[model samples]
Target chain A: MNIFFFHLMPYGDLDLSYTDKYDSAWVTLPNTYFDRSKGTAIYDRYIGELSLADELGFDGICVNEHHQTAYGLMPAPNLIAGALTRTTKKAKIAILGRALPLVNNPVAIAEEFAMLDQMSGGRIITGFVRGIGSEYFASGIDPTLSHARYYEAHELILRAWTEPGPFRYHGRHYSFDYVNIWPRPVQLPHPPVWIPSQGSIETIEWCAAKERKYTYLQTFSPIELAQKNFDAYRACAEKAGYKAQASQLGWAIPTYVAETDEIARRELQPHIEAFFNKFLRFPIEMRMPPGYSSIASTKMLIERKYAVRASQQTIDTLGDLGMCIYGSAKTVREKLLHHQKEMGIGNLIAMLQIATQPAEQTEKSMRLFAAEVAPYLRANASTAVAAE
Target chain B: MADNVTTETVDVRGLKLKVQQAGSGETILFLHGAGGSNWTGLLDRLATKYRVLLPEHPGFGRSQIPDWMMSVGDLALFYLDFMTASKLDNVHLAGHSLGGWLTAEIAIRNTTKLRSVSLLAPAGIAVEEAPFGDVFLWNHEQSTRAQFHDQALAEKRLTVAPDLDIALQNKSAVARLAWNPRFSNPQLPFWLHRIDKPTLLLWGREDRVIPYACHVPYKNGIAQAQMETIDLCGHAIHNEKPAEAAAVIEKFLSGVKA
Candidate 1:
């Protein structure tokens, strides 16, 4: 499958023993624990790991946005994408993505993404997200208006990129008298749009209707659940009068590789555990704010009970559940290949750099994955070929 | 008291509303807080003196929320239409928490229709010193704790499990109305002066949700307004101290001419 390296750029030095003092790693977490000097070193190391991934010939490098959270330090993924444009060559700069609802000005997104697309020489993939519910609190945006704002912003950005703007645009959530953008995108029509979701049906249907790529964020869920969601997405696309190709489907999961299974487990298990039990330890209220999700979706979520299990996940449980992949290069390769064949996912975005994982360890995992795992998968599979 | 309470569905404009009506005399409309609509003990105590009309806001309980009804102001207008359709004039108005905010909006907009306004722990005034706690961010347990001074009473009230669908529906409706500008209207202080009728502002001394400091702006802005603090009470003053809340309302309403 097409391999992409995803970086959360986490503050690896967080004292796990003291995580109990904070309600979550998100909005309410005290900033006193964050050391600026340590943060500077972490950024350089994380970005250096991404640069290594580029040198190792990964198909893409992925970054995303989160607010007021140690879960991911990228409040602005665009800036990171811009930095990647200057440092990395050939690998697509995938900002997966900018949270559309949290942003006050949609045109600024249009302008920035266009500038990045031109700077990267048409090697940019734009991903749009309705930020997680905690972001509504951090950004002071109404969670009730999230869907409306997201759709409006998406429409505004697309039109600004394609249509000759400076045209008046009026929407329920936004209104612009003079809608014009300079330095229009290098990609014709627009850069390819991808959407990542936790399998919200509304989002799946929207993505299907728009004929955009849909990436399932299998965050701490069982493989069967992801498969069911993928099936639903394919069915949704079919109902929209088009069959979804493998390239239109993607899977993002935590992955780590090493020389042997024992070594991989020994080295990565603690970091993986901390990532789930600590970094992702958000209270239910913070994760799903009032009106952030629909009644049907909320009811479905309650019935499934995935979120409860996710909160209590241990490293071993996560691995057994297939929420994460950690093993020898051979074992990791086999597992990924099985997932690709079974789920029909063409793109595999591997999150090698986890919470508290050393920079040297991340680089070693990337090199092993690139040398031992990716080459075999690339040679044997034709359907997993990159869309570009 | 239990036998006296009866429930009915009333049509307001195109929306259907579930209303609980009790006793018979001068009409008194009781608006409930953000916590879904229910028959509370205060309703029964008030029912003994005057007819208490408790209608679930358009989106709460068994009510049907029309798409156009999106804000607290829209709810105020809906209630106005309900009064007009019911052929009631110079009716007494009372509300709690979010309901209190709605009552103020109605009073400001339709000054002639109401005889007096009673706001119990109302949440429409912005106070810098004692900012309102974010109820949406709190879990059911945290919210219950913050809403009551008596933890035992809160525990007793919150023991029963909530129906998931109804809980989600109520929370969603509350978010639609009060999520932005948070719980208060920035322009509400400017318009409170328009409400010329006698107003009663009841606050809980230990209300951790909407602070007691919110009383200042309401008292200062409205003419002929009286402010009272209920000691050892919380945001749900009516629920926490039903008898006292009822007695205060009864005394206030008795002096006003309807």
Candidate 2:
């Protein structure tokens, strides 16, 4: 099993008192709270931390995009990935990913990724996202056209990379006179594409199609929900006349590990509490908006994720549901190994640096996860591990 | 006020449009707000003297969304096609909020069949002075209560019916039309002058959704428009002050006919 370090790079110095003042830590949270002096230093520290993850022997490092919100500082992940390439040597750099429909120019993305792929010496895994609904409010892209725009952008980007360029590429949402991207990618037929989602059914089906069997990464969802979605992906693959590989399924989970289970929970309590309560307090409208997801996906998400606000959830409840995992190396490893066997997850995207977790604490968790938990999982990858 | 209220599907542009109508006399083609409710008390009051017609906009309640229907401009064009298909002449075009925005768009484009246009708490252009009360940011309940000035009435309405699923579906339709511009067309003020038909602009003094500040553009732009404001009312003027709103609109329509 390959372990990847995923960082949201949130405002670590966030004044939790904003919980009393704002609707959420997202779009509505006043920017007055973003401590200016600590800004560049945080980015400097975070990039250094990701580079350390590469040094610490993690197989890959992941970054993603979000806008006008403290939930993620990276409005542009490609730049961060570009910076990481100069700092880190061997780890796969996954911009997991750029919001496909938000950009007016998919060709620019083709260029950017191709350039990043070249910079990273062919070790780039591109992840395409429809972006969150809040981004539509931020970017003024029509939510109703999200599905149409996303699929079109996906095809256009693919064609830009594969098809010989200086060609005319035209779609309903985007049109380009020249399809040529200058920095041709190092990886032939384009770099590997991974899709990280909350398991939108359409996304699952799309990822499983025979022509494009991208690795489907389920992020920040309950174990049951993740299992159901992965099963659906396999079913989709079977219907498409192919059996999905174990490597095609992945789970991106925020995890913390320590010497003992009690110590781990105690140390992670406040950070985990603030992460769910403050950082993830997405009001129904702000999160889903209107026509952002299909009604079916909306209904499914509401039932699983949104029905219970993160403010009401705690470390215990989140852990029980498999939304978060924090414990001793033994407990964490056993749970991961059990779930890996139970649901064919060949890739483990561990988010060791949780929200508001201090720099020192994060470093401790990362080292422990790397030194203890990851090695056990790697050693027992294909074994039929029994649940404790 | 009338016992003859009836509903039938009108085939417009290959989609069955659900329409509710009552009474006789001159035709009042009433378009609903973003809320997309059926036959309100305001319409019932108007129905006593004029034939009140309410066609559910596509993607609204009980109305199947046509594949090509995308924006308020498209909906405005659909209503124009609806009028021609229904063979209505000398029609009084009336609409509320999103519907009011559509009324302005339709009249500006072509007013040959319109005798007068009534826009209540219209939302077609932004008011720089006061920000649009962003319902997209507020929770369903907060946004719902923000719609009315009378808390008791708002509470009563919530107590009776608070279906977020249905409300969300309607909002989805609104997002398709109004989300991009944040509920206002940049060109609306420029074209408001073309709506030369006898025009009425009614606003609620305490409206939080569109704000009373927004009425300025409509009042100043439409040369024939006479603006009126109702006290103790919010954006949903019909829900909060149906009788008062109906009385003002009734008097205006009578003056237009005279």
Candidate 3:
């Protein structure tokens, strides 16, 4: 399996004691708690870790975008991707991704991604997202128009990358008299597209139809949920008349490895708990605004009580539910392999760095995993491919 | 309270809408707010004096929402077609909250067709000083509580669990129409002068949802409009003190010039 290093780049110096004072570390969280000097140090350390991952022969390094949230500080993943292009070598700079609907001009995204692709020598994978519901409030975009805007923006960006410039375009959400983007993407027909979703069927079908890679995000949910979603994606691909290859499906989850299972758990549990319980503690109304989700998904969410469970989840329960993977190298490898087999995911995006995790400890975990875990997983994946 | 209310489906522009009607005198076209249509005590009270017509706005309660019905203006036109389809003329228009906004829009466009207009906590006028409360952001309990003056009434109103399908349908419809400008049309204050008919602005003094102070803009904008505030009431004025709200509406409608 292809192993990628995912960094959330959270503000690592948060006063954990004051977490109870706010409803969440998201949209409504007071910025007075954020320390600038510590933030600069964290950013430097986070970038250093990503660079280290590239140097250690990881297949890819991932960055994502979130707004007005301490969950992940990178509001513009493209900037980080641009920076990574010059600093890192041989690793795919996976911007997973830019929130399409939040942006007013999709061509600008097309131009920027194309520039990154060229600069990185075709090592960029562009991931288009509708963004989480809170982003709509942050960017002041109507949540109801999110789906329409996202699809339209995706189409506009794709056309800007592929179609010859100076073409007039008219869409419901966007109307540009002149559609032209300079420095079109180096990869033929644009750079490879990846979609990181929590299993919205519409998104699954859309991605499968377009033949883009579908990355299942383990957003503090049980393994069964991810498996069910993966099954749905595969079914969607089948209905679209294509057998989904292992490479077409991916799983993104938090993972940490140490010399022993106890050490890994001890090192990871508090941070994981803080990340989910504190950082991701947005209320249901804030997280999924009115009309943000489809009727079916909304009903499903209510029935499943997904938000309630996510908010109340404890560290022990999350580990038991396989929402997070942490242990010694052998244990981590086995657990990851189990997920790969169970979920049929070919790519594994490992979030090695998380909330309030010390930079040195995070790097050590990453180094240990790289040395002892990645080779076995890579070998197994190639063998499985060769056998096929 | 009227007991013989009949519900029927009306088709306009190839979309189906559920309409409730009762009594049989001069027509009183009733428009419901964002909360969806209901056969309330106020409607029953109004029915005693005149015919009450309550058509569920497209995208609310048993109405087939046309894909193109994306704005309150579309709804205003739909209601005009509704008036045409129903073959009614010189009807008195009464609207509450979102419905009030729609009523104002209709009156602005077709002042002659509407004999008089009654707006209860109307939501179209943008008030910079007293912005409307965000009911969409509140939980069911918070929203329900905000709608009434008495906690017991709020509890009673919320006893029935909201059906997910209906709630989602109503929310999506509301979001499509009002999420951006946030329950108010910016140009509405400019156009309010076109509502030439006698207008009544009723507000609940204790309204937590739409601020009571918004009554001034409506009263100022409409030439023949008069304002009244019901004490110990909330945004859902009719639901809170049905008799008082209904009495005010009845008195206003009684004063409509022939």
Candidate 4:
């Protein structure tokens, strides 16, 4: 399986004790707590880590956007991806991505992505996301228009990339008279499009359609939920008159490796707990803002994922639930290989740096994962080979 | 109490609308707020004197929204078309909250059909110091409670929240219309001068949603406007202090008739 490094670049210096006074680590959380010097250091160090991942031979490096949150520092993941272009070579730069619905100008994004594609020699993997509902609150874009806007923006971006511009592009949500982009894209017919999602069925169906056939990367969801969604994607592909390829499916989860299982657990425990319990202490309304999704989609989400709030889950239960992976390299590889075989995921997006994981320790873990776990998985790319 | 309240579905711009109407005098088209139109005490008391016509705004109650009706601006235009098509003459226009905002929008556009206008805690103008409450951020219990001065009454109302589908439809419509720039049109204050008809502004002294502080702009904008403040009341002045609010409106409407 292809290994990619995913970075949230969270506020690593967060005084986790903020949970005592504040309701969440997201939008409403006061920005007074953000330390400037610490922020600058972590940002530089995080980019260094992405470059390190490239040197370590990961196939791709990913960054994503979130607004008004201490959770992920990159409100503009494109900037980080751009920085990667100068610092790293060979590895694909995946901006996993810009919130399509929140932006009024899709053409600007088209130009940026095109420029990045050119800069990286066409190594850009365009990932479009409808951004989480909490983002709608931050952007002040109508939540009711989210789904419609996302689709329209996606169409507009695709058009701007492929078609010769100064073209009149009118969308329900956005209207543009001049649609010409200068750089266009280094990749033909536009760069490869990937979708990083939180297991929305509508997303799966749309991405799995024959015309699109975009890679669908399930992000930070439980493995069972990922499997169910992947199966749904396959079902959609079948309806669209083709079987979905393993290459079109991927999984992103926070992972840690050490000398032994116990040592790995001990090392990751505080950071993982703080990550889930404190940083992800979000309100239900903010998470699923009204009109953010269709009634069916919201109902499905509530039914499938509502029982346990992110704050409620302990580290052990989270591992049991297949949300995060942590162990010795051998254990990590075996579990990942098993899931890859079972779910037929050809890509594994490992988040090596987590909430408050020290720089040295993160490097050590990444090095171990790169040296030991990555080679085994790369050699045994096809699960069918291992099965025999 | 509901015996005189008659219901009918009317077609406008190829969309269906359920109108709850009663009494028989000067037509008072009472538009409801973001809360959706219901058989409330304000309508009933007013219905006893003037003919109170309460139609669900498109996308609320029994009204199925047309794809074209996206924002409050569209809603305002739709109402103007409905009024013109129905051939209503010298009618008194009254509205609450978002509906109140719509009432002003309609009047400012063309007041030839309107004899007078009444706005209860209207949500059209933005005041700098006392910004309107962020209703979008408030959840069911918190938002509902914030609307009334009496927390007990608010809780009681919550137990009987309207049908799930209609309530959701209403909430969605409100969110779509007033989500950004949040419940107030930026240019509404500038256009308030166009209201040539007699205007009545009823505000709650303790309206947590749209505070009493908003009255300054509304009063200053409409030259021939009568303003009143209901003590110990909130945004839902029509429901919270229905009789008192109705009495003030009744007195104003009577003087307008004179």
Interface CA RMSD, all predictions: 1.2, 1.4, 1.3, 1.7
TM-score of chain A of each: 0.95, 0.96, 0.95, 0.96
Clashes of 3: 0
Q: How many clashes show up per model?
A: 2, 0, 0, 2
Candidate 3 ranges with C-alpha deviation above 4 Å: A17-21, A210-220, A306-311, A385-388
State which candidate, 2 or 4, has the greater DockQ.
2
Best by lDDT: 2
Docking class of 1: medium
Error of 2 at B8 (Å): 1.0
User: What is residue A311's positional error in candidate 1, in angstroms?
Assistant: 7.9
DockQ result, candidate 4? 0.58
lDDT of 4: 0.87
lDDT per residue as tens, model 1, A171-192: 8888999889988999987898
**Native-referenced Cα lDDT, model 3:** 0.84
Residues A331-361 of candidate 3: C-alpha lDDT, one tens digit per residue: 9988887778777677888999978888778
* CAPRI-style class, candidate 3: medium
Winner of 2 and 3 under DockQ: 2
The TM-score obtained by model 4 is: 0.96
Rank order (by DockQ, best first): 1, 2, 3, 4
Each prediction's Cα lDDT score? 0.85, 0.88, 0.84, 0.87
Per-candidate TM equals 0.96, 0.96, 0.95, 0.96
